[model samples]
Target: MSDALTLKAMLRPKFRGALLGVAVGDALGFPFEGSSHSFMAALGPDALHAFEAHRSGYFPPGQFSDDTQLTLATVESFLQEKRFSGKSLAESFLPLWRENRIIGRSPGCSEAIERLIDRTADWRTSGCEEGRAGNGAAKRMVPLGLWNYDEPERLVEEATLAAEITHRDRRAVAGAVAVAASVAYSLTRRDLILGEWIDAVAGATAPISPALARHFRDLPRFLSMGEKEAVAAISKLGYDDPATAPTTLVTPFVVPSVMTAFFWFLRHPDDWRETVGGCLRSGGDVDTIASIGGGISGAFNGIEAIPEALRETVVDRDRLIDLADRLHTLKEAVRSRRGA
Candidate 1:
C-alpha cells in the first residue's frame, strides 16, 4: 500500500469518478440510444448539451438506464457482503428485474434474469447462452475492477462470475474482463501509455476469446487518425447485428462496442467530455459504449475531470459518490489486512 494519504488523495477521487462517470455517460447518452449518425449530427455542434434538452420521452432528463442500475447492484453487494458473491449479485439483480426498474434492458439479459426470477436456472446457469454476446455484462462489471484492482486472478474469476449472471458467451465474458481490467489498470497507472494499456487489457482477454483480444490489439492502428476516421475504422473492425445496414453507430455487439469505448477513451484519456462525446457520436448503443468509455476515462482523470454540469445532472449523484467512498474504504481495509 502507498499509505493512507495516497489512498485518500489519489484513489478516492478515481473511485468516485469511475462510478459517476458511468452514470453521467449513461444518462447523457441514454436519449440517443439507437440514433443514427444523422440524427446525432442534427443535434448540431453543441450535441452534448442538446442531449438533455431533447430527452427521451420514456425517461426523465438525466435518468440512467439498466447500465447504472445493475452497476449499483454490484457495488451494493460488495459493500454489504465485503466480498464478491455470485448469489448476492443475482439476488440484487432480481428485484430490479421484477420491478420493471431496469430501463432499456437488452433482450438477452432480460431472458436470463427472468430465468433467475422464475427459478428455472440458478445464478451459474441463468445467463444467456454462449452465442448471445452483448455488452450487458461489461457495463456492470466496473465495480469488480474497483474491488479487485490489484488481484488479477480474482478479478478474472469475479468478472466471469458477474458476467455469467446475465451473459455466458466467452466473448461477453472477455468483454467484461476487458472493461473491469481496464478500470483496474487505469486506477493503478499515473500516466497513460496507449500501447501498454492495450497490451495489458488484451493479454487479460486472450485466454477467454482470442479474437476479441486481437481486436483490442489492433486498436493502435487508429491512434494517428482523427476521431471520425478512427471511429469509422473501428466500426468496420467487427460484425454488428445483421438486421441493420452498415453504419458508424457502435452496435450492441460486445467486440465493436468494447473497442469503440477503448478507442474513445484512449484518444482522450484525460478529457471525459471528449471521450464520451466520441462514443455519443458513434450513435447506436450509445449508453453502453459511453458508459464503458466514461468509466475508464474517469478512472484515469479522476472525478474533477467530469464537467460540473454533467455531474450534477446524473440521478443519485450523491449516492453514487457515497458508494464510491465506501468502496474505497473497503478496498483499503482489504489491502491493509493482506499487507499485514
Candidate 2:
C-alpha cells in the first residue's frame, strides 16, 4: 500500500498481474465466447458465473480454457529450461491434452497434438489443414515476451517457433509475433504514453515476417483511427467472415484478432478493468481477446489495480503468483549473469 515500494516490489505485482490477468479474463469471458456484447451485457458479469460452479455442466466456472492452460504450460517449460524450445514447449502441451485438462482447444490444435503424439510428422508440417490461422497461436503467446523482454529478435524467433508448433499459416505466426512483441515491450516500462507504446510494439514486431512486417508498419494508422473507424478498417481484411450464415461473435482468423486486441489495448493502455470491458464488448473470442488485452494492460498497471472480487473469482491465485515470482527470479538471474 506504500508509494515508497521499490520497482522490485512493483515488478512482482506486475508479473503476477500479467498471468493472473490472463486467467481472470479467460474465466470471465469463457461462457460468452460466441455471444454478442449486447446479449452478455444484458445478463451482467455476475450472472455469467463468476464463482466456480457448473452452469454449463461441462466447464466449471472460473475455469480457464485452452488459452491460460497452454500459457501456463509454456511458462512451466521456461521455468524448467531457462530458454525457449518449440519441441520442449510442445511436449509440455501433451500432458494437458492427455489428462483432459485442455478445455475448448481449437480443432487445429487438437489435430496437431494428436499427430505430435503419434510421432508421425514434424511440427512444421503437423498443423492441421483446417483452422491453421485461428487465434489459437496468438492467444497464448504473451509469455514469450515476458521471458525475452527487450530482445525483439529473440522474441520474434521464439514466438514464430511457438506458433509453428501448431499453427503453420503465416497469418497465425504474424499474430503471435505481434502480441509477444507487445508484451515484451510493455514490461520495459509502466508509463502509458500511447504513441511510444504502439511504436515500441510495432518496432519489435515488424521484422518477424514480411506479412507481419507490413502489417505492423500500418498499425499506427488503424490505432489512431476512431473506434468505429478502426473496427471498420480492420474488418476489410475478412478475419471475421461475416458473410457466413449464422455469424458468431468471434472469428479464428489472425488479422482481426490481433488488430482488435491491439486497438483496445492501446485505447485503455492503463486500465486493466476498462480494457477487459472493451474486449468483452467486442465479443467473439472474448476470452482470448480479453486475456491478451488484459495481460498487457496488467503488465503496465500491476496487480494492485486488479479488482479484488475478480482476483478472488479466479481458481489458482497462489500457484499463479508463485509462477510469476519464479519467472521474476529467473529474469534477475539472467540479468546478473549478463552484468557479471
Off by over 4 Å in 1: 1-8, 50-58, 240-245
lDDT leader? 1
TM-score on alpha carbons, each prediction: 0.94, 0.88
Instruction: State, as a TM-score between 0 and 1, how close model 2 is to the true structure.
Output: 0.88
Task: Kindly report which residue pairs in candidate 1 clash with one another.
Answer: none
Given candidate 2, what's the lDDT at residue 173? Answer: 77
- Please provide, for model 2 over 183-251, each residue's C-alpha lDDT reduced to its tens digit, 9 standing for 90 to 100: 876676757665676566666555544655565557678877876566555544543454551232445
Q: Which stretches of model 2 miss by more than 4 angstroms?
A: 1-9, 41-55, 128-131, 209-229, 232-248
